[model samples]
Target: MTDTTAAPRLSVRTLVLMAVPALLIGIGSAVVLRALDLVSEQLMHFLWDWLPGQFGADESTPWWIFLILTLTGAAVGAIVWLVPGHGGPDSATTELGGPPPKLGAVPTILLVAILGLAGGVSLGPENPTIAVNSALAVAVFGRLSTKIPPALLVMLAVSGTIGALFGTPVAAALIFTGTVGALALPGSLWDKLFLPLAAAGAGAVTMLLLGGESISFTLEPMGAIQPIYLLQGFLIAAVSAILGIVAAFLFPYLHKAFHALRNPIIFTTIGGMILGVLGIIGGPITLFKGLEQTAELLEHPEDYSASQLALFTGVKIVALLIAASAGFRGGRIFPAVFVGTAFGLLAFALFPGIPISLAVACGVMGITLAATKDGWIGIFVGIALCGDITVLPLLCLIILPVWLIVTKAPELTVHPPEKAPAAAPAKA
Candidate 1:
């Protein structure tokens, strides 16, 4: 009888060779992300600190925030209109795993991303940074070696960028599990994960070495998982998921409304002005992409009243929707995290007995799931932010009901307008 078993397709030598480029790309991508962070920090410092100081105005001056955001909108609008490739594709039209834009589009994408990040536009660097890294890797590797698969290059770039963003390979692995697990080809699931895991490990290590901080917080850990807490967590997540669904339904309509202007300059500039107004009302706490702000919120949860937290949540959701739909180049994850945190704090204020960490984690999971439509990532970020393992079992269980709520919810993506057919010839 013929042997039914088959040998492994990739030998150890071949695997090691593939991993070499993955490792290099991971480390290199992490360094680039760090550099972007530095540049963004400098710009933000200049805008919020030095510029205000020069005007003899404190950072709390509401007019300055308004003026800067309005101008930022105008600047971003100009870049989109004048720059080549129209500042890359509209972020609203792309998913996290979508194909990277052409290499030539990278410059404009980076420019707009930096502007949005530093100029307090209420967006995250996740989308643009990933796209940039992926495009760069695909171009460089495609030219250097035809042996490397394009899919592999994209996978490495995405995994590496995610690793750097989350400050760990674990997040990358969890995030990509659903994507990789569905592949029909390959051996075991780990076999498929081998190269991406290698890249993620390198990226995470490199980012840590460069002094990048992970999204973690030290909270009062749960002593033990309780049935009551699980019930509460499920309820909280369900509520948050409903809120997220509401936002998802609103997303496409808002996107279309903004695009109705049909000119990037008019629409983006106007969107920026509205964002500036929201920033003024919401204060400094509601501005920016929100990772640092989320930490601040957790550290001083008592400082904010229930009303303030509610306002923060509402304003942040609006900002996220507007920033994404109106030509901003960034991701929704960080901003969604902020919204989730605000809602969690609001819940805590209302119900003092419920554990704050659990409440916050549930909120994060629901909102992130709604925004990214990725359950594993949502749960991971939720647990990671609280720095608690005890909450994992609860989260894993709670995510089921939350998933049901969001599964059929409209996705937070925009469809581009179709070009009208040319008019019939006048002679006809």
Candidate 2:
């Protein structure tokens, strides 16, 4: 009369088995999303540049341009009006926090993100890419309807998403896993250990075929920082943080103003005209949208005099704020990075005697505000952007003080609070 059916602890081999799917998801997602990114880039290049030239337009249309705007408007309007969950499944409830809704929404998010990017909105494709990938994974897994834990599903989805977006399974695994863990999701300690390793390896293998660099940026330290140089770096971080806070505050209001316009096509049309005028006044620094400007700022920091750099930085902040507000459909991460870099470059010129290393550090360190309220994201960015991993500690030291000063104001609340069954999550 004895029945012994106790729960079995996961063996090392068993844990590894769970990780296998995550690894596959990561690799598969990476390959697919990279292709998507390329496709988006080509389409954007054609629409924003080639098509415009062919049409002989003197200026580029607003990112929302296109007969598609009417289409986008009607489509989005319908989705908003009719789809019960068009807003999307609650991300906060889902554990990943604010991700795309439903497996079916993946295609919709991809289409919207690509169109938005092509329209030259000031956003990055990474977020939308992540959303699409996650949704796809969710759908595929959901169909199986297997008895797998939801926590495992979330981790796998995130792993897949990171691999696809960053092209570095390891970094993606680390960051995404950390993000999930920080959010207090499920999965035992054993699950955490093997999952990332497997996912990262898969991601790495995928990127090897994709041909883009696995890491986004690296850092190299100058070594043995003296006091004054340190102080200068601190100052640069401080100023950039102040600027970031100001940007955060302005973004919400601008977005509201654009939405208030009611009609999408006319609103977008007016938005384009307004941006064009700003482009004229601000010069090419405002053109090609944010990415081009970020590149120019990094390469030719000296080309911009101190005054010009300051003016350009301020203009970009406003430009991004307005672009996002006008329903341009881009992400803000790039603009923030670009603006931070510009500010750092300008600070070097203005302060004089500051090391270029310091400028680089400050530029990245300052923009961390946009990464998350936690502030450490900016520090990581400061070092990560350097293209040398060794510089992280130094970057962190300098960013700490600046983060403190800038955050002294009422903190900019960017993401909605974590909640279950919230409204629709954005594509990104």
Candidate 3:
């Protein structure tokens, strides 16, 4: 039987017509994303700023961080235990751009995402936003037109959400290439991507209009490529990639360890306590998703000694591992970027003569590549964070060897074992 939900060879006319809904989806994605960010930002201020100040203690103090994170975890666990949809699929177990999530789970997922973000969990907003947008898009579009397959709608929603997240349609194209490339569609690659691209472009533009900020920094551009610097970039990227691979390899085991606690509330609460210790050890710099912290690290590299930078890198990696594993709902990319940034900055602080921007960009590229397992995004974000187009050619060449090692590593997601089937009835 022909499944009505399966994607067919969409005609050019049908594809073009789909753009209208795609555009709407993109706009809606941006709106929801913006709303979530704003709400999270406000709550973050309340928890990390207003409340701490009212109590006359610095928010970054060890005791305060410990209390907040532990409590946040307990609250989130309670939500997962009692809330509708159980906070959606655990972020640790799902791949970005994989299956469409249930629409009913959207609110709880967003709530936990907001808590994690505002509570200083070492994670990002990508997975949750994509999940919610994809869920809503599928539900709305499915009702509007049964002819459009759920996959098509999900692709559009993911493209739109990624575009908004990164503030560029280009990111949507590059990161999505591997996933979309496998479809044996009738059109050329670009033809296959046309509608999604439209949605991405719309989402980017909407985000820009809504005052989205791009990750950027001021650094002297790399001079004409130096042969010596090639080796330098390769070293930085390779080392950072190795760290990412280690975390990826450890993900599933850590997930099992956390789940062995046998209760969502208990495991999450314990995870929060561990994260608090990491925050105290790494200081305030290693908390959150690392976007703002990455900027801060770059703006004043001198403030962090090489040892402190090393601590930041190591702590951030561990924090990310625990946060993802212990049932926290968030993305891994931003924290990975933070780890790369600190490691890169540490290299510069120690050596003093290497091009600082190159070190940072290469470091970011390597880790992002390993973390995402996507070469295009790694290069793009490395360039994005460094804000230097001149580093692009060098990053391109440097990622080759690093990619080889990284390709064999497991993804930074978990695969919990399946349970045995129930016993057959004894009475016959």
Candidate 4:
């Protein structure tokens, strides 16, 4: 069976011609991602650091966390209400590589993304980075050549952004495998992938050159994988995925509830208050996108009790949902990663028998798969977190049951119901 959607096949020559453009797009993507990060970082320092010190308040205090988050929500809500583009569409209704926003909306999208990130919103930069890069790349490069279709340009830019965001082209390739597989163009998959990979590689290299951080963390070398580790991995991952499934089920309802307030400011402000409370409960560790926190967990596992790890896991899941449900503009991956890490650590702490690497890897694999419905990234992040190839074979098996679990469950996104066409007048 094959897809019937007809797409023009590109010759190797055309693909070769586009490779340079793809490479350029990749560089641009990395630059955009790094620029957003830099601006967000500076703003984060001001909001969380400089502002707190002036009042003789520590950022870790509940009052400060509550104040910062509430202010952020108000700020974002004001922009969404007043900004010309309204920060593009509702981010809760979007997905990674889903659709690009209008060119005019790119600036607003990037703006809100930075706001959410620096405001300690529990989300990542993936979706906005891709959204902005794809929009700009297509609008800019579409005029430069007719041979390259806009769709491919979107692909090239998305791949580049993914590469830069993850600090590796390999991550981009793994992520796009399903996308290419679903395309109807006739060619070897590699042929179809040529330009995108070029873009991804270029973007990855640019990010590396620009000192972008990576997602990888080193786990103490656990011994070779035992047969029992597979079962343990599956169990841990399954539990995590089940929790993710709960979030998936609640996603739409939560989104609907938040938007019920109508005005973005009111709903987002309330959401921020909820997140601030969650932050106080989970402490500073639960704030931000989860990369640095995840690394912190691995580096200092002894610092947290099992109950504390569990609290972190649960609080993060709620925070992610609220941040996502409310109109905060960002991706879910990083927050999910943090949740998965806490779950893994909690599992290891409780069992004491499961290998730390296996537990963490499976936890990441399960939760990510359920959270995003993307197994490739689940596997990529699971292995990347532990830096253990030993767990790869087991993650492959663990994903099977996890997929079944999420197969029928709703995806963690919302879709606005389509309006019925207006009835035409029967009388002339």
Candidate lDDT scores, in order, read 0.86, 0.58, 0.88, 0.88
Model 3 misses residue 305 by how many Å?
1.6
RMSD of each: 3.1, 6.0, 4.6, 3.9
Could you tell me the lDDT of residue 339 within candidate 2?
77
lDDT of 4 by residue, 1-428 (tens): 78787555778776777788999999999999999999999999998889899998887989999988988898888888888888887778887777678899988999999998999999999888988998999889988887677878889898999889888898888878778866555677787777779999999999999999988887865687688887888899999999999998899999989898989889888888888998999999899988888999999997899999999999999999999999998889999999999999999999989988888998888889998888898999999999988778888888988899888887878886765557543521
What is candidate 3's lDDT per residue for 92-188, written digit by digit as tens? 9888877877888999999999999999999999899989999999899999998777887888898998888888889888876767766545556
For model 1, the stretches where C-alpha displacement exceeds 4 angstroms are 1-8, 181-185, 417-428
For residues 132-228, write the lDDT of model 1, one tens digit per residue.
8889999998899998877778888989989999999988898777787554335667777888889899999999999997898867777777789
Worst ten in a row by lDDT for model 3: 419-428
Clashes of 4: 0
lDDT for 28 (candidate 2): 67
What is the TM-score (0 to 1) of candidate 1?
Answer: 0.95
Q: Candidate 1 deviates by what RMSD? A: 3.1
Worst 10 residues of 2 by lDDT: 88-97
Model 4 pairs in collision: none
